[model samples]
Target chain A: MARLFKPRMLALAVLAALASRAHAEPAAAPARAEVLHWWTSGGESAAARTLADAFRAAGGTWIDTAVAGSEQARAVAVSRVAGGNPPTAALFNASRQFRDLVDQGQLTALDDVARQGGWDRVMPPAILDAVRVNGHVYAAPVDIHMTAWIWYSKAAFKKAGIAAEPRSVEELFQALDRLRAAGLIPLAHGGQPWQDSIVFRAVLASVGGRDLYLRVFRDRDPRAIESPEFRQVLLTFRRLHGYVDAGSPGRHWNDATGLLVAGRAGVQIMGDWVRAEFSAARQRAGVDYGCLPGLGEHAPYVIQADAFVFPKNRDAATARTQALLATTVTSPAVQVSFSSRKGSLPVRSDVELPSPDPCVALAAALMRDRARQLPNDEMFLTPDQAGAMADVLTAYWNRDMPVETVQKKVVAALRDDL
Target chain B: MRATWAARAALVPVALTALLGYLGSTLWTAQMSVTASRTLPSDHFVGMAQYVRLFSNERWLLSLDNLLLYGVLFISACLLAGSVLAILVDREIAARGWLRQIFLYPYAMSFIATGAVWQWILNPTDGIQAVGRALGFSAFRFDWIVDPDRVLLTIVIATAWQASGFVMAILLAGLSGVDPDLWRAARIDGIPTWRVYTSIVLPQLGYAFATALVLLLTGVVKLYDAVVAMTQGGPGTASEVPTKFIMDHLYGRANLGLASAGAIVLLVTVLALLAPFLYARTRAAASIA
Candidate 1:
């Protein structure tokens, strides 16, 4: 009891000292931005560090609070704002996340920065629309990620007697069968909800075509969901489930990529971030692994962007920090450098990528075609609806649930979202 | 008066802490639950709408069901295993101190590391399956973590392994405080060992059992880290718990309205389960007085 009591007393004393000393760092005159973000992974950390380094170099002190996952970092930021201790700026995805923040008057408007930078001319309209809440910019776009990309192991393909990339879904499945016949796991799936949705969206685009994809996810049309086109998409999504191994359930996304890296798996339907894992393994791109934008020639390229939002702060010093952050995150040189390490395309349309990763170049080329651009579910639907739809999709994929039943649940979830 | 002043000063910190940390957060969460908050809290009031959604969510409902199953199994297993281990250790066994340390060591390590180790150990391809095949047990299968129906059981097993030691330590302390004279008298009366234990010794452990139960119950209510680190509430959310459900919406889903409702529901559930027992204890105490 004495030992426990003594430690508790010490802890209390230390906490009391810290509590009194909170936010009393001799308020610097220049903008001192405290940024909370989820870029703690090696590549992501490097990307964030470059941004911070630039911010510091440009007459500011960059205080970085690094958390691991996007979900966790966002939660901390939101809670901090509620608790009346909001950070200067925090990283957020380019989705509907900032809508609620803006509704609560928690985020500061960045219209001044947008005008100063002439963001209207450079940033894509879709990208601009995602950040703008009621005709005002709430976030600064950092990087863009293309979600519907298929990564394959060259060694696994060679072993399976696949000479080149498959242009269509039929040939893709045929290649998967050949890989499985060669005694390799065909689809390296993580089995998490997000990864499951990614593969489903891939199939929806490649098999069901672009209009049907948009109608089901974006429009949430009941007829579209019940149509034969959507049913084929669901069937194709479920068909890929057969190629995945039993151990794929509840597996981490990185571990699934590990199978590909080890040549134990043939293909992974993942985002551009898989390139980071391949690079980390010291494997040269195009030699060790190959990336396909979509299964077919004219498939829509699904895209998601990561961005940062500045929460509204009354303090002048904190406001200055927010303005600096908005300016620093969107600078062209910073965008290209940060996106290069992150395996994502820069949000700015004009910036040229330096990395010669054939996969990234193909994605860049596809991204240039405005007609091929597709929004992820989050870009169109509320986070709640997307999550609910993901739950239904995962349940359908995991079990032998009837497609008709899934369609009903999808409609029900969308109705609930309203 | 001076002593009283010192006592009041000592309690000032605790009172302030309880008010600011516990009560304040509770009120804040309760207030937020009634509002139409989403990714962030809004001032607009939308009474019970979030609760309606919470109840409608299949994952939240499944998590609530899993929590009940996990709570029952985990608390019972820990209590039984702890009591048995305490009794065994209390005997004139060789190297008793070493054995006690071995049993209690798991409690010293964080559950994050332990959960990962257990996940690897229970994984089919890399763990027991490989070893089983290596040992010529070709037909052996120990992949409970991947089996949807059996995944919760795996969580229970892993959690019980890490927690039973703490229970053993508590029960051992209680067992040591038992009157040695009672045991000597029982032996002289020629009473059977099993009977002596069940009738006399077990009854003396009621207070210790209560303490262990409360500790384990608290653990059951907040069982997020182990489940996350091990299964991530998956194999299709089979091992999902209410705390994980609340946390997922609180952050990942960015649906605080639903998260707040889940938190309130969880709190009410814990209070409802604990109230009757607490009331009974108070009544018993009053009657004895």
Candidate 2:
């Protein structure tokens, strides 16, 4: 009995020592950050890892909590924040997606970081406006994705005998006609509502012009929506629906991109992310494929951005970690590495690309012209309003809704009361 | 008295769970429905405005219509197919266990898997239509999955295929419980087999049928996964259901008030439909007691 008691006493002493060590470890430990994002795809995960590696290199511990879909990730982040166990940082669209978080004071303002980093002069105005709310920088803009780009398979275009890229809305239709005549699918379109909205925005920006597009989306003026020019934009948008094959409905966007990759389809109106798909297929842009930022010379460049917002925390250590992440994300070097891997334009245009892809070069060139820059609909409208407008557009795209009726529906969808 | 007190004490945790876990959250949701809550729940009351908006919203209305259409078609088809399969298996065919396994297999798989398989099978380019065209039928057209008008039908086909097997399992258990003497009497009376099933056998399985109906009705109300997996309520929100709408509003759209309102309406609808059935079931139980 004395021998057993002696062993137990020694065990207790050891356990107490371990517990004390655990209690003392937090003070001198590195800044630990848990970042939640939705970059689960192959290329996306690689891009996300660059930021994580950079943060680790900056003397912080990076913990990745990747949820697959953006909506699911944001849902998890919002719930965690509301439940009072928020991550250090969470990814969100550089839009009105996180406005509620800001309004509720659930996010820590990164004003000091922004000031130190000179975010005001470096970040694009559209992205800056999105991340800055109530004169406080609440998010770090990582990359700018031009959402409305016309991606055409060079093989399909050659087969269709189209010589030059369409310079105007009329010429675009003529190219579609040629592609259709070649017996290939004229358009590789996914019939999802968001994809439909991408096509609609492309038409609105290229056909309706910048002023009309702003009036319709930004100003939400009913007069602009009811105008003849907007009607023509709607008509062009709907007419493109005819070029999509019957198999288009319920198809995933990646599958649509796969059609272009295999040269079974001519053109796909999608974001710059499609370049990643092309790259994965070993297709070189401007040789195997071509990306048109917009159809005409002066077409508006519709841009959306992915950003990271730091959730509010009272701990100074956690705040330091958040600041480290914000700075690392927007730093010129990390931005180039991340955006290059992700096939997106770096948020800071002041940074030169080491070796930009042709599509990125074009986007970079277009980015230099501030007047050509336009924010995507998500930037101008709330998520709910944007979803409502998407529903209207998708219904019109699938069904034969009259353009006049659709215009009224669009007006109603964008109402302030809604 | 001590035993009774112990029994009551044993029920305390369950009581607390029901009160707090279920009732508390439901009350919270109801409170949120009347407020102008967006991404977060706020106390700013709007007083039935969300319900008003929900009723007027075209997507919500269309979702309701789709749910009703899908529910009726799915429930009826499941019942009919299940009853027929049960009768077929009740005849004591050889390899009955294997037959039962084959029929019950789909029910064991998740709705997500079932929906995905059916999505591919119904796809126009490389699915059954393509197969048919390959087999010398050039004019074959089975593109309902992509057609806005017929997309919902594809969902019905996939989900009904998944659920009918479950109904069969339940009804088969009931079929086994029917007294052998009744079958002997039907056979002795020169009654046709089909008549025996429709008239005598089915009427006696009323309890089992009610149980299956309740389960299937609840499944219908919670019809989200299959729709999400197959059509994503797409081809232009053509196959959208109430549950999917509420989920989208709750998370993606960040309209908590509207989502809560939709949830409450869905709950009320389910309760209204099930109340009479439950009343009758309790009455029948009380009469037996």
Candidate 3:
């Protein structure tokens, strides 16, 4: 009886020690941060690690609560704030996504950090407009992504006997025709609505030029939407549908990128994030693939960005950590490293990038020219209006809806907008 | 008299839960439906404009139609399959425990994983269609998962696979309670086993079937996971359902007003449909007593 009791007492003592050690350090806990973001993929995780490393180096304890999808991440953040257990900072798109949170006084402003970082002068106008609400900056811009970049396979182009990149919409179509004639799928497109809209925007800007694109989306001008020029752009977008493969519907964007990686497809109109896919397959930019920003003159470069907004917290440690995170994220050195891993351009134009990334170099050069800078659909339209318009466009793309009907539908969708 | 006090004490929890959890949420949802709430709840009332928008939206209309189709097919298939499996188990088959576990495997899986597996199996290029073609049947086509007209049927198949197992388990519980004397009496009357099951057994299991049907109906109403995992309400909103529409509006679309309106509509429709059935249940029990 004595022998058995002694061993049980020993086990109980071990458990007590473990429990006490776990509970001993609550008062001494460092500037603790619980960041919530949707960066679960391998490359995305690597990019996030850059930020985590920066935060840790600044004497903050990093706690990552990475959710996989953007909507799920935002939902978790919303529930946390509403339940009075908010995270230190939450990732939001550099759009009006967090406008509701700001309006409800659920987000902490970063005016001090923004002023110190000189964000107004360094950040581009479209990005500045996204992060600033009223008079104060509410979020820190991390990286800038250009949607609707034309990515093409160099091997596929060579096989199709095309010598150079297409300079105009007509040339691009002719190149697609050549790829088709060479017995290849000319467009490696995923049939989801967002991807569909990306392809449509690419055509809208590159084909119809910048002003026409803005009038339809930014101004929500009904007359421009129903105009002959916009109709022509719509028809051009329809023509690309013929070049896509039959099994394109319900395919993931990565699988569509796989087609280009394998050189079985010619062109994929996608965001700069596809560069990560190319890199994953060990494909170089200029040698293995090529990126076209837009059709030469009068082209508009649409920008999208990712940022982190702090949940409203008066805790001294949380405030300190949030300020540190803002500085780390916006710093030129960290932005360069994070953006490189993220497969996008740095938000600051002054950030030095390696020359190997020809695509980002081109985007940065276009970024310097304010005339070519355009906001993506998310930057201008609210998420609801954007989703509604995307539904109509996706339906029109998949179904046999007439262009005139689509024009009318766009008008109806924007009828209630401010 | 003391036992009466104890019984009354037990009613307090039920009463509070019904008032605060159920009734409170329903009222909140109804209020929000009238207001132009976006992302967060607001007091800016816009009357029935949200409902007006909901009715006019083509996507919402498609969602309702899809839900109706999916509900009918999923319920019928699950009941038919469950009844058949329950009968097989009731016959005292060999290795009954193993068979029961195997049949219940899909019910234990999360719908997200099962939906993904079904998506892979039904995907035209890499799934069964490709395998069939590779085996020299070049004309094979199993593209219903992508086709707008037939996508909902594929959802029915995937959901039925997950739900029928659960129905079978419930019916088996009911089957176990059948008095063995009834079988002996039927045998003495020279009644066939199948006829005995159809006539004597099925009628007794009515309550179990009703329970399973109610559970399955709730699942059909909140059919977000299977649709999102399998097709994401694509290709071009082909397989959209009411819950998915509400979720998209609530989160991705940031239109809480429209989503709340949709939720209220769904809840009212379900309650209205269940009212008669519930009334009949209570009346039948009263008559029996």
Q: In terms of DockQ, which candidate is strongest?
A: 2
Please give the distance, in angstroms, between residue A191's alpha carbon in candidate 2 and its true position after superposition: 1.2
Off by over 4 Å in 2: A1-30
Writing each residue's lDDT as its tens digit, candidate 2 over A1-418 gives: 0000011122233343334333322324547887878787877889999999999899987777776567767777787778677778899999999999999999989999999998888888988998888899999999998999999999999999999988888888899999999999999998888889999999999988899988988999999999999999988899999999988987878889999999999999998888888988999988999989897778897998999999987677878888998999999999989988888889997898877778878889899998999998888888899989999999999889889999999998998743
- Residue A300 lDDT (model 1): 86
TM-score for each prediction? Answer: 0.91, 0.95, 0.90
Off by over 4 Å in 1: A1-27, A115-118, A315-325, A416-418, B1-9, B185-192
Residue pairs in candidate 1 whose N, alpha carbon or C atoms collide under 3 angstroms: none
Could you tell me how far off, in angstroms, the CA of residue A113 lies in candidate 3 after the best superposition? 3.2
- Tens-place lDDT digits, model 1, residues B127-199: 8987998899999999888888899888889889888888999988898899989989999999997788778
Point to the candidate with the largest lDDT.
2
List, for all models, the DockQ compared with the true complex. 0.45, 0.49, 0.41
lDDT (CA) per prediction: 0.82, 0.87, 0.84
* Residue-level error in angstroms, candidate 1, position A104: 2.8
Q: Could you give candidate 1's per-residue lDDT for residues A195-306 as a string of tens digits?
A: 8899988888888888888898779899999887788889889988989987888777778889999999999998888788888888777999998888776888788888
DockQ (0 to 1) for model 1: 0.45
lDDT of 2 by residue, B62-144 (tens): 99999999999999999999888888887867877887888899888976767778989999997999999999999999999
Clashes of each: 0, 0, 0
Better of 2 and 3 by lDDT: 2
Q: Estimate, for each residue in B55-92, the C-alpha lDDT of model 3 and write its tens digit.
A: 99989999999899889999999999999988987686
Top of the candidates by TM-score: 2
